[model samples]
Target: MSGLGMFGGTTIKYRNPTYTRDHGSLTLTWTDEWKTLGGCDLQEPTTGTDTKNREGTLSQYTLYMPSGSPVADNAQVRVDGQELQVDGMVLRIPDPLGILPYCKATLKAWKG
Candidate 1:
């Protein structure tokens, strides 16, 4: 809830996650360790030297899962330490888990 102090509430097209008394909070986290943002080519180089930040917008962002998760909408994404709702498409994580600045300079792969 920290988008310039303007949190984009969950979209109406998608409903909030249903919780139960037996279960506390269904805190779901994105596990897209694929090291790739769907298509954002911000992977670091294999030089094994410099690990600077990439100068580009993340082409695609993915939400992580621990199991065979079904496609769901309005899923809450937690970047870095901030928790935010992934509304319809347009994502603006003001407080990203910071960016993988080194991702563009280092040679690695995400298998999440």
Candidate 2:
């Protein structure tokens, strides 16, 4: 599996959310300590809704990470196990004669 097709597609588990502070109350708790890190690729979700989140329904996915792949910034992805949360800044696509540099995360989930 080395044709560079988004790391051969479908296989994601990236977790980076550790901020715990609850003793005097400042409010900051996001504990997700999962680390699997594989040839990630998940792109098949495009549902939207607005109007001030009428009932809530937004599913957007486009996660294909491999280059450097540290995945931080609202990071929490676990495909095939169902757990998606990473919707901001993970875009790092640079392959200007550098072989393969790919990383684009934007997986949002909301259903109600």
Q: Name the runs in model 2 displaced over 4 angstroms.
A: 1-16, 23-42, 46-54, 72-84, 87-106, 109-112
Per-prediction TM-score, please? 0.21, 0.31
RMSD (Cα, Å) for all candidates, in order, is 15.5, 11.7
Runs in model 1 lying further than 4 Å from the true structure? 1-60, 64-67, 89-112
Please, what are the lDDT tens digits per residue for candidate 2 over residues 1-112? Answer: 2445347456677667666667866542455567777777777766544334487767788887788778787877878877878886788888887787788878887777
lDDT of 1 at 54: 46
Q: Per-residue lDDT for 1-112 in model 1, tens only?
A: 2222222222122123433454565644444331212212222223433223643322234332211122244444333433335433333332256421111111122222
lDDT by candidate, in order shown = 0.30, 0.73
Using TM-score as the measure, the top candidate is: 2
So what's the TM-score on candidate 1? 0.21
